[model samples]
Target: MNMTPAPKAVVVGAGPVGCLSAIALAKLGWDVVVYERRPDIRADSLQASSCEIPARIPRPRSINLTLSARGIAAVQSIDSTLVERLLYNAVPLQGRMVHHLKGNPTPQQYDRQGHCLYSIERGLVNLIILETAAAVKNISIKFSHKAVGVDFKNNVLRLCNSVTGQEFDENFDLCIGADGSNSIIRHFLMRATQMEYSQHYLSHEYVEIRLQAGKNSSGDTFLLDSDHLHVWPRGNFTVVAMPNKDKTFTCALFAPREMFDNLQYPDALIPFFQAHFPDLLSLLGEKRLLSAFQNNPRSQLITVKANLYHKGSVLVIGDGAHSFVPFFGQGLNCALEDVRILSALLCEEKGGCDPSAIHRVFKHYSESRHEDLIAIGDLAMDSHLKMRRSVATWSYTIRAYIDNLLYALSESLFVVKLSQTIFGPESTGWIPLYSMVSFRPDISYSAAKKKAEHQKRLVDSVGISLAILGLGYILHAFINLNKLL
Candidate 1:
């Protein structure tokens, strides 16, 4: 009797997204191996490499994030325990605390009722996902192994271990690239098939700075608000802070590249920080500020767009497929959801699918996800403008007011329901891109936009009705007073 072999999956990159992808696939009974270009992230300690940060300098580790309900729901779907563990260490950001031009009466909150995002250290989050993947018996990890290139047509991969100049060829039935923006796997797959791709780097450059904690007499921590994301928005640039598990904060100065490049030395950095972000200088201190400016790397923000993310046995997800600017704070969240969607699709196919099935599913994913990814990417870019300028605009304020009203009405007023009920969560699941991409399983990005559009229209209709009713009431009161006269 002859026995068939289990289909194998090769995942490139051992980052949070990659690790999660491997674990998700393993859960579906696929033989999986994950490869990382760098040494083990679990063993390495990097300081505020990602955008998330804490409140106070020489501070302990903290991360800046907007862990919304969408992201939370996605993580919970796969591993509720993991979500619990994350929440146990997570800091809820009820809303963004927008610091107005100095001496403003009050700060702005993102949501009136206090529904905020979250702040979670990138390092710790990656560690948890990696650890979870390690626990899965069917998943294997190869650290310090970099993919030099790949032959997508042959389903073969060439990898080099950094420590040793050892090279090897591995054949797999499928390859999933989570290798980040500059994905070698993606480049290889594109060569074998017709793939459309575009990448754009924004004019912005981000510099991460430390804000040391102030100790109380009891050796406790003393600082400003610890429960909110603090943003001091300047016209052209901004300084933002996110709280850490510890008693400190990580602050970042995001400015145009030209501005950063013009200031070449540590001393120049001090003056720049003082001029643009006065309070941060006092918090970070001159010495530490200089060190961070001169020593630490300046992060560049970019948007990567790919037409098709898969071909034959090779596929791409996460940063490899769609990496947007950090303004939206959706990169990690979206990447996590990508795995959930991919896993659900592959699981639906079951064991009977051929090698091309995975590739075909990915093709569908790219097409369906393209609009949402583009929309979010565009939204992220637009948000940078909104954060800096539109927060005070009349149009923005009216939009915000209408948005809140609709959300409240949807939850409160049951008499008139939204159109979503007709489509339902499954049929219209494609419509709530946020719900589908970030919350539900197998729904594409484009579908979510359609749902959101429909929801927006409903909100608009209600708003118009309210406006007209107010006008009628005012006119009626005037006529009654005239009759009395």
Candidate 2:
């Protein structure tokens, strides 16, 4: 009896998501080929001088990533060792430190139990995943190979070699597109199928800045509290800083394009920073701030939403399928989760490496993951407003307080028994929306969204009821005082 050969999977774009997908496929005994448009970042880092600062510093183009539970869970699912390696150099951000112009900064913890986000340099994490893929025996990584087009009917991907300037085609049993927001595979899928797609660019753009590592009055290496993500929310725009393992911070200034364009000349940045981010100016020196303003590239924020991630043998994941703004810091987390979900679905198939079962797996993945992708994308976009403005408001604070309070109370012995008796054994219990979305991998994104919406309505109703009762009490007191008079 003859056995069928192992299935082959061609992955475009060797970013974090693509590399994770390749690793997943390789672990399942499939031959995986990953094509990256740029040179291997690991090789570049190795060749650079030891004294040279990583691309993350001095230059104002780095985007720091916040790795939360979703991303951590997904990576752990692949291999817990991978999670350990990726987070070895990461800084733990316990909460957001909201900076104020007139007062001292206030810290807002993400969870009641002190669970926090891991702040890692984006490029570093990508390099780690790519290197991990390179070590897998069944996975082959081809660098400087740009994917230009695809032939869905023939199951062939067209690529151009950046080094040799030669065009070639590779056929595969499966093609996964993790090429990011401007994915070439996604473009092909749009033409091949009736896939609905939409993209929205936020008016706000961002520029990166670095806060140098130095000792404070306390003699600590970190200038700011390394345990928290620092934010200066100015309503229309916000400046955020994340700590690095080296004690320095990668700060990003997110503002309207008009605001950035107005400060085209370096001199204009002084007044702008003085007015909006007065406290930040002393930290990011006037000279460095002005230089970054004049020289750094301003990148646009965009959200991409697409339906039917898979068509025929081709499938799109990560930013290729859905891209979100960075406000919620869920873009990378959601992308990694995509890999975890897809891998599980594929593994459950009876014929693991059979080409015939590929479509079934793809279809199931597309159907199962679409809603969650859209939910997280919308949540990320909405979070920009909340982070920059609502976070400073009393209403937002009270609601969050109530949400957290309910979650804490729900865990108490008395409340748990009472809730169980009142709502019965089927009760899901109380969980804050942020906790559900960030900490609980068991809760699906769509389910979390629904639960949050329901919780919001309940909170609103109770608030209104209390306000009315307070008003009635005041009126009754005034009437009684008048009668006594």
Candidate 3:
């Protein structure tokens, strides 16, 4: 009897998505190799540099990740034990605590079923995923190795050592470009195939502010609800915060570059904070707030979308394939889902280095992923308006209540009745757009967007019917349809 050889795979970039891809491939009996240009993300980028104010701040990567249903499901799909390890020290956010300028904060639960999101540092998640990938038997990680070029037809990557500057070539049965937003693999694919691509930088810039956890008068340690995500959404400009295990809140302010430039003077920041975030100002303290605004790095947000994700045996995943603004907090989740989807698709193929079979796999992956990726990109970019303006409106509040009520009555209690009445005979059940996009991994992004539009129509028609017939007029029927979407 002859033993079959394992399929070979090379994953570029050792970020969370790349690591997860390597692990998933290895699990399918693939001999996987992961290449990273950096020494070690933990030491090189994930950890703080001499310039950063906080010792724990990740240098190159600033924004923390909000892990929702899609990300959780993907991790669970990869390894059950891995999910436990990742979520052990994470902060669970049950809902958004919306802070208004002149009134009390409003708390909105994510779902009645106690659904929540986990907030973890970008560095920590990347580190954990890399470590988990390293533990896999057939996966190997190559640090300080940069992929400079690629040969799509032959499935080869031209590599250069970061420290030594020596160049070499390596070919694999399958090569995945998990190299982030500025992926070399995507570049090579664009040259080989006319891969549609677009990237834009928003005028908005963001600055991270560290809010130290407090101590009450009794000297007992206290915090601003570690279980809730804090937000001061002020229309075009906003401030958002997520809790850390160390009891600190990682707060970020998003404003136009002009605003940031105007407030460059030390004196301007406090006054701006007082006017825009007076309630939060008291908690942030004068000293820390001043220092954070002055010293913390301000960064720009970019959004990218590409078509034709694969050509030949090469494929791009994560930010390399589709990059979104952080507004909806789906960038990382979608990327992780990419790995899960790719892995599952690969598992369908027979364990052999069949070139034609692999090409077909790549073709299927790109065609299937296109619409879903485009849907997410649009949603993530537009969600900023919904978060900043609509959340505080009476219309938004009423819509939330109605959505939940309809979901319960239709989905939980009367799925058949709903299908006949409001949703046509084809309707499955009511799902709030938020629930569909963030909490339902089974539903693709494109499907969720389509269903959301249909739901909107039904809500409007019903509300109008009640009013015209002199039944109770639903004045609180949602109005910001464009922004809310």
Candidate 4:
């Protein structure tokens, strides 16, 4: 009996999204090969356990991602066991702890029902996903194998072995680019098709700052609130920190290019911190802050969008298709969702894992996924404005409070009463934009954007109307009291 061989797929970029794609394909009876330009991170016989706490994470590049519902669903969809492993290495952030310039820090919970986002290191996520992909019998992860060229017509990828300086051609039934914002596969794909692409680098740039574990009088690990994301929000500059399993906090400051340029020397570090972040100096200390300011690389934030996600049998997923600013904390989650969506599309193909159906599947996936990707990019950019300029403003705070209050009211009084009403229950009621985007995985990015706009208008109108009514009631009572007098 001759058995049909599994279809083959070559996935470029072994980042978190890339690894997930390979795993999904492998499970669907496809032989997969993942090519990464970087050397194998685990090559040094790095210990198996994520427990050995390093003084600092080895890699300088990390976005300090939070695993939200969309990302979590994607992970669980691939492997239920993976989420547990990732959670082990992650910190559950209940909400953001916003540190003001003067007063004490204020804690804002993400949701009334207490849905927490797990803050996990970017490197840890990739390593764990890579390990999961490695365990799959049909998936092979080749590090230091940079994708140099592509023959889209023939589904051929030209790779260069960085170690040996040798080049080779490999053919696949499908080629996937998860190679991040600056993807070689994306570059080649553009040459092959009339792909409309736009890349905008914002004035904002980020630099890493480390905070070693602090010990209290009891000698237990303590630093700020480990359960909350710490944010030092200044008008044009914001410094955010997320907890790590090693009892340390990974912090990054996002500031305008002018601000970063102004602090380009050792002497400028302390004074700038003193001017905007006076209190934080005590926690980070003088020496460490100076070192971080001097040594860390300042990375410019970029937003990327492409008109076409796929051409022929080649496709771009994750950052390759759409890269967003880190303000919304959706970069990782959005990338993970790409894998989940693509996997579903592949499964929907009538002939499961059939090589002949590749083009049709690619086209369908692109058409279905493009709008969501575009929506998220726009959402992230909008969020950048909120985080940078509006976060410290009273109007923003009031608006956020009003929005959350409305959501709580809807969930409790309105939604409950409406659902139980003889209205025959098909509605989910009002879901907050933040919840829809972060906590609600089923809501598409485009739908979430549209819903959010509608909700914002509703909230503003309701809030204004209620305020006017309250004032009217107060005035009417005063007028009646005066008449009695």
Candidate 5:
């Protein structure tokens, strides 16, 4: 009789990507273990909320993210039940409603047919993922297991438990690090192999504010457009809101580090909000603003680029490989995709027990994942300018209109494709490669962008035709009016 071997894989970090990574690997028949330095996020919820905790708490102005096709698909790929649960609690953002500094309202739908992104609480989402992981029978999740160092030469992970401060070492058949931006795993891998890395800190700082959803004259729950991501674009800074499952919204203010420093005390804070984020004051309240402003820590944004993602027996994914600015809201989405792709690749290479084989897989992951990571990172940074300034400009509105018109002309096939990729029952291959990459199961990020470009051209052709037709109609109407005059 022939019996299958129990393959073992270990993951660092119990964050969303890390949990999802363990889940995906477990589903592939690997005995998975996830090590997190902190306690169960739910158990540590209040304890985690220190004003000085830069590593744990959210930065005020940073966006939580709009989990679109790619992100949802990745999560669903691991467990459909988990996907349903996520959607049940999520706040759907059907479009971006850009509020100009001048107070003009314009909306842009993410999908051609008006499909939207979902707004979820980062902390809550992390909790759900972590809890789901804990329930997996084949997976072992050890909280408070901080990875202090890694030794690739002997395939060893050195960790210190937060509660005990006792040091220990664990060996895995294969280890993956989803340990995030300041990953110790990546640092260790660099020493064993030739790895190039660059870290850049942006000039921006962000602060979080809250908005209430009170009954208006009609007694509706939402104060702003509930199905849209609302933004107040102020040059060099911005205020954006994402709705919660509850009637409230989470608003964040992103500004320059210098500007944030100027807001030293609670008194200066109120007047500043009144001048810049005037609409938010009534909801945030003078007292809450004063307290939150005085209490909350300023969050600094940074981007890290790791050239080689792994060495020897270990591999790294998510923010450990590339950390980006939050403007595009793709940070989480992209991280989730990393797990999907890496899992599929490892499966393709067959269940691994060999260290050299694992090293080769990491090489492929780094090389293949690079283009998509770089492209998205660049797009995210570029979006900061758009979110803070251009969202209010005439050019921005016109460009959006053109983009939408093109999307509409495509018969919204890509939109349908996106929905299918994100919400459909089929596996990754059924969708367009872009849909697969962005929302499907296994396509790479670079391939997704390539497919998106093809679809964009088709949409653009239709838009140009509509523009020309509209112009022709105007010309004819002018000639007829002149003759009548």
Candidate 6:
């Protein structure tokens, strides 16, 4: 009896999302091939070894990512051991340490029940995923292989080997574009079909600065609190820092492009830092800040969205499908979630590697996942405004307090039973918007957004009623006082 061969899958890009995709497909018995434009990060001698703690290397620009419940759950689905390895060198961030110009920093916890985020190096996590992919059977990783073109009609990808300067074409049963914001596969799919694509660039640009580990009077390495994510919100812009395993902090200064343009030289940066970020200047030192400002690259922020994610046998996931700002720290987590959802959907196929069934799977995925992807994209963009300004405001803090209070009350057994008896099963549980998005994996993004909208309306109504009652009481007291007089 002739047995059917395993279906082949070609995944473009070798980032975390790409590597995860390869691992997922390989586990499903698919012959997987990964192509990356850049050389293998694992082969780089300067990169930290798998067993060693990673050190912060000075890069022109870097964006630190936080792994919360979503990312953790996705990795756990793949392999529990992988999650352990990824978090081996990560720092736990229990809350945000809001830095003020003239006062002590304030701490704002992420969740009420002690849920936290893990701060890890982006490159280190990528390398770990790469190593995991390397160990999986039936997976081939081709480095320095740049995908130049795609033939949607034939399911073939054109490539160029950077080292040998040779071009080739390869065909696959299915093609995945885990390639990032500037996805070449996405570009080809747009021309082949009616893919509604939109790209928006924010006015802000960010630059990265590394703060060396400081020593205490007793000679122990100490700087800012390692357990908190430090934020220096300055109304219009912000500087945020995350701890590293090497006792240093990786800080990124996000500001308007015009502000960056004005600070063209080292001389201008000194006064600018001293004027706005006096405390940060003292921590990083004036000389180091000046050097970073003058030397580091200023990277632009852009959000990319597409209405359709798949065409025929090709599909796009991760940043390629929905690229958003980093304020919410959901970009990487969402990408990993994509892999988990897609893999699960593929595993449900009845006929096993049926092309028509695979196409149906893709259609179902695009239709079901589009709204959630768009919802998270919008949330991430809106979060940028909150982080840079509203985070430091009293009104925002009060609103957060109310939100968390309601969520906590709803979670109590007494309240849950009372709500169910009084209202219905549907109203038995309540969760804050942030908790729904970051903590609850079972809750879909679109459902979370809708629930949050309903909660906001209810909260607003209660607030208005309370305000009116208080005003009426004050008015009545004043009238009684006048009558007594």
User: How does model 6 score by TM-score?
Assistant: 0.93
Between candidates 2 and 3, name the one with more favorable TM-score.
Answer: 2
Best candidate, TM-score: 6
* TM per candidate: 0.82, 0.92, 0.89, 0.91, 0.82, 0.93
Per residue, candidate 3 scores C-alpha lDDT tens digits across 165-275 of 999999899999999999988988888888899999998989988778777776634367787888898988999998877677888999999999988775898899899
**Residue runs of model 5 more than 4 Å from their true location after superposition:** 1-5, 43-63, 215-220, 353-356, 411-444, 447-485
Q: Cα RMSDs of all predictions? A: 6.0, 4.8, 7.6, 4.5, 6.3, 4.3
Question: In model 3, what are the clashing residue pairs, if there are any?
Answer: none
> Who wins the lDDT comparison?
6
lDDT of 1 by residue, 1-485 (tens): 99776778899998878988887777777789999988765543323222222232222232265566556656766666767666655677665666665554234545544555677777667766777788788999999998987876788989998899899988898788999889888888678777888899888878777676778787857365777777777878887788766766777778899988876686677777777666667777888888877766888888898878787777888888888877657788778777766765676667314766776777776676667677777767867777676664567667766666654555321131211111113342112223333333333355555566787787679779999999999999999999999
Global lDDT of each candidate: 0.70, 0.83, 0.81, 0.81, 0.74, 0.83
Of candidates 3 and 2, the better by lDDT:
2
Over 408-448, each residue of candidate 6 has an lDDT whose tens digit, in order, gives 77774322221112111333466887877787666667777
How are the candidates ranked when ordered by TM-score, highest leading?
6, 2, 4, 3, 5, 1
Cα lDDT over the full model 5: 0.74
Over 4 Å off in model 2, which ranges? 1-3, 44-60, 216-220, 412-427
Across residues 294-374, which tens digit of lDDT does each residue of candidate 2 receive?
A: 777888898899999988889999999998898888888889988888887777774356666788888888888888888
- Measured by C-alpha RMSD in angstroms, how accurate is candidate 6? 4.3
Where is the poorest 10-residue window by lDDT in model 4? Answer: 416-425
Question: In model 6, which residue pairs have backbone atoms overlapping below 3 Å?
Answer: none
For candidate 4, lDDT tens digit of each residue in 378-402? 8888887777667667887787787
The candidate, 4 or 6, that scores higher on lDDT is 6
TM-score computed on alpha carbons, candidate 2:
0.92
